[model samples]
Target: MNKLLIVGISGVTNGGKSTLALKLKELWTISSIIHIDELTKPMNKLKYDSILDYHNWDEVETYDWERIKKEVTISSQNLLNSSRQLACLLNFYNLHEHHPILFIEGILLFNSPIDEIFDIRIFFTLDKEECWKRRKERVYEPPEPPGYFEKYCWPLYMFYKSELENKIKVDSSKSSNIPYNINFIKGDKAIDETLLWANKEIYTHLLNY
Candidate 1:
């Protein structure tokens, strides 16, 4: 297959997008998964003056978009020479597939340039309180201070929601007017069920040659 299949899984922090992406990656061993969180890096480390001196990692600016777009475009297009070069860059020497499935997951992707590249988009959802609880358990380099969640995290998440509210839906499958590429999934579902649903959708696009 010379054509690539690109799947996007996006949602709020602790909304289970990574868990699903990892499961999908493991299911299809040849598949490549690009996680936005892993791609994130702060702009500077020496300029720190106070607790708030560091850039907010939760915000979208921390990610390297130029690198991401280039790699993702190459992966999706499956240009043979580009594929080999990218594999070398990523240090995965064994990857020989010319057209591999690409799964990209991130916290905020709706309004970004990265959002427009996916062939299929899946957005996970969970209750705000549940998300907050899970987010608290996760660690950050510049640790989130007291009132940070209330002031920064929650507010930014809400802003994200506001941008996507009119554009996306909670249950796109139930409505015929919804776009075929956009899918909504509830993160509270059983892991097996979620994986089953995800695998079904992914495999449908991968008609066995």
Candidate 2:
């Protein structure tokens, strides 16, 4: 039987992780695509509402990191219950028994223990300025306060970067004109271009294995 091909797509927030995941899902109909952000959205919404009373960053800073981390972890784990749902649905279809591919896309996917679960890992890179600009434009709740990106997400991403090996990193800030040799697709390109690149790379990797 073919073993599962677990591809992890990860990057800093607003680095196009979700867009790339959606493109890959479109490209690979046979593979299952899981987006952790969708699962975590409800928790984020609740937190956003609850924090509205806090005037600004300084006020929010009154909360300690240790307590914040514990709260966030619990919320995140609750959100991950969706993963269990997917696993059950897959088993219902006997997906793993038949050895179908699986792709999980999220930020911090390579953070510690979860890093070991994937067979292939891809990171999307973008300039910090570009990321900030995109985050500001998001239609949801509102933009994070200035410095939040640097203080929070970037440090975690850098930590994950140091630990990742056998990973493909794609520069998402580049225009579509430039050609990349890797199978990992960047969000800056057209869907067709991304699909072409992804299909070629995925097939090549499968063949090699």
TM-score of model 1 (CA atoms): 0.74
Best by lDDT: 1
lDDT string for model 1 (1-209, tens) is 23556788987777888888888877764577778776665557223326654456556676777878877866556544555566676766433333367889987766577776777788887788888888889988766676677766778777876677655554353566535456778878887898899888766655542
Spell out the clash pairs found in candidate 1.
none
Q: What tens digits encode model 2's per-residue C-alpha lDDT throughout 98-197?
A: 3345677766665534556566666676666776677678754444555555655566555555544333234344555532222233445564665566
- Against the true structure, candidate 2 has what lDDT? 0.53
lDDT against the true structure, each candidate: 0.70, 0.53
Please count the clashing residue pairs in each candidate, in the order shown: 0, 0
